[model samples]
Target: MLPHERSLVKRLQSQPFALIGINSDGDADKVKKILKDQDITWRQSIEGSTRGPWPTKWNVKSWPTIYVLDAQGVIRYKNVREKAMDEAIDTLLAEMKGAKK
Candidate 1:
């Protein structure tokens, strides 16, 4: 997922897009090391404790959940499959571009 996500980030580097990760990893250090190793440059909010407030607030019930939000912060896609994320992003990016004009 990280590799695919990295590719999306690279492909959309010129557009108004962001991939925000909400990590529920118990160990901050381990998460940090993993992020560094993966070359993940996006902003991530790490939950140091298991099933922390973030997950509860967001109502995340799955291990790996994907939420694609628009520039206005409205959720445009929820639980989007990894394979289809790029297409969703493309749609949103196009919408954003149209909005700007």
Candidate 2:
């Protein structure tokens, strides 16, 4: 993720952002349901993580990673720790506000 991507993610988190999980491990269906259960809407990009567009293709290495992106399609946060969603959201929101001006 780039510096601008971080800023964009912070902005999105301040409002409403989507949690997209790109799994190349063929567990897309299972993970989709989990996110739904949490009332979080997500999309599974079946391109198998390692064979996608630039940047994503290079950085992705693990399964079940979360990427929070803004409406502009710029990644705000990637490889987010699922256990720290709350803190991440709070920090992202605050950062977004700080960078708004």
Candidate 3:
């Protein structure tokens, strides 16, 4: 997942795309290590625990919960990955281009 995420971030460098990581790790030290070891370049919010504010509010039932939001900050897709994720992003980018014109 990290590799794919890195690819997405690199590929969308010139676009209005953001990959915000909401980490639910209990230990802040471990999270920092992960960020460095994994080479995570995107922005991250460090929630204290799985029961932390972000996860609690979003009702995250799984570990790697994925959400794809549009330019207007609306959640358009959830729990999608790989090809489906790419398709959703591509469609949204195209829509963004059409909207600009």
lDDT of each candidate versus the true structure = 0.83, 0.55, 0.90
Candidate 3 lDDT over residue span 1-98, tens digit each: 88999999999999989899999875778888888999999988889788888999989989899999999999999989988888899999999999
RMSD of 1: 1.5
Using Cα atoms with residue i matched to residue i, what is each candidate's TM-score against the true structure? 0.88, 0.44, 0.92
Candidate 1 structure quality by residue, lDDT tens digits, 1-101 = 88888888888898888888888876678888888998998888888654888888878888788888988998889777667888888888889889989
Error of 2 at 71 (Å): 8.4
Q: Which of 1 and 3 is the better model by lDDT?
A: 3
- Candidate 2 residues 5-100, lDDT tens each? 345455556475554445454456765665566444435555533656533755756655566554455666766663455466666666767777
Question: Which pairs clash in model 1?
Answer: none
Top-scoring candidate (lDDT): 3
Return the lDDT, model 1, position 80.
76
Would you give me the overall lDDT of model 2? 0.55
Instruction: List pairs with backbone clashes in candidate 3.
Output: none
Number of clashes recorded per candidate: 0, 2, 0
Pairs of residues at least 3 apart in sequence or in different chains that clash in candidate 2: 9-76, 24-48
